[model samples]
Target: MEQDVSLGLAIFVEHGREREAADFYGSAFGARQFQAHHIDGALAGVEMRLGATVIAVAGANPRREAEPSRGGPFFPKVAGGVSTIIQLTVPDIDGCFAQAIAAGATLRDEVQTDVAGRRVASLFDPFGHIWVLIERDASAGRRAA
Candidate 1:
């Protein structure tokens, strides 16, 4: 059975880094590519699944820059300035963090327990998107019990 589309993210990667972003997501987050969109034999976009969530990855829209007033979406021009941050609740933060680093993610913050009792870390993929990896603190539940 196919899942109905609800909320999905469309990330416009930096110019010529579309494939790299897709690969990083696959290795670091266990995402699976289900579809690839092409234009005149060149890769245009990709659709991938991270668990049940779907994400669309594409190259920067040059048209948007030429038509500034026709604003929609465009590749991030500056690091640490991207408007959206992807948050993933994982079963193993340490393992996922290691995988992300190994896959070329730049560490923004080391894993640490937040005030809410969740272990969280942040990293930037090669393409400039910020990803927050989170793991619920098991000890908090044990303490409550």
Candidate 2:
């Protein structure tokens, strides 16, 4: 069944960490890869779906001074850290958060209700992407405000 994806996210990791990122997402979030593009037996790009969201993982484009108009000279958040956060709306925030931690994600914020009353938790993936796991089910037990 083909999904009519309206919008998509493309994330670029450090030049050779594409496979690792894809694999991590798969194990931690149960993402299923729909396609993987390779170059000379090396993984170049991958497309996967986590529920309704389509996420594309790829290696950062090489930094070239001449190609100033290129889509990226993208760099992974190794030092300064990234401002983008990949938020996953899941049915089991606690379980998923544990899985991500076991899969090498460093816990950033423990699971708690945010100011907006959403049950949320955040972490930094090994590849340096920040992920926020959110459980929006009203029955999931939000703290009394």
Candidate 3:
């Protein structure tokens, strides 16, 4: 038998913007920041609470930004240098997506209903963080996503 382990997701934002990212997520998810870490008096990371889920945000690090052999600023060649996709379940899909847009998020896709009967939408925050709003039909005896 294999041992099971819990996994946590972490996202890195550009340097000097960890706090902004965390706050943006807080507003978008209607959550709050419960912890934060700093390096040399500058915010290096933050952990936000969304109900029972916690997501970590890390500050930009040149060492991890681009090709090490190519040297610093590891920014991606195109948009969204990151690889993490954050999905959030909200009571109202439209309302939550609108709130995110009002908070400076760029709409990437409008809400669409899938065959599974779930409403989903995508957007990018100012820092280029990707997010998806999910609204599952719990009343259909389904659980939240």
Q: What is the TM-score of each candidate against the true structure?
A: 0.87, 0.82, 0.80
Model 1, C-alpha of 39: deviation from truth (Å): 1.3
| Top of the candidates by TM-score | 1
lDDT, candidate 2, 54-136, per-residue tens: 99999886564236586564755572277678889988899999999999898889999999888999998888888889996
Candidate 3, residue 29: CA error in Å? Answer: 1.1
The local lDDT score (0 to 100) that residue 32 gets in candidate 1 is 94
> Tell me, what's the RMSD of every candidate?
3.4, 4.7, 3.6
Model 2 regions more than 4 Å off: 1-5, 64-73, 140-145
TM-score of 2: 0.82
Candidate 1 clashes between residue pairs 3 or more apart in a chain or in different chains: none
lDDT for predicted candidate 1 compared with the true structure: 0.86
How far is 142's C-alpha from truth in model 1 (Å)?
A: 9.7
In model 1, what is the error at residue 36, expressed in angstroms?
Answer: 0.3
What lDDT does the true structure give each of the candidates? 0.86, 0.84, 0.76
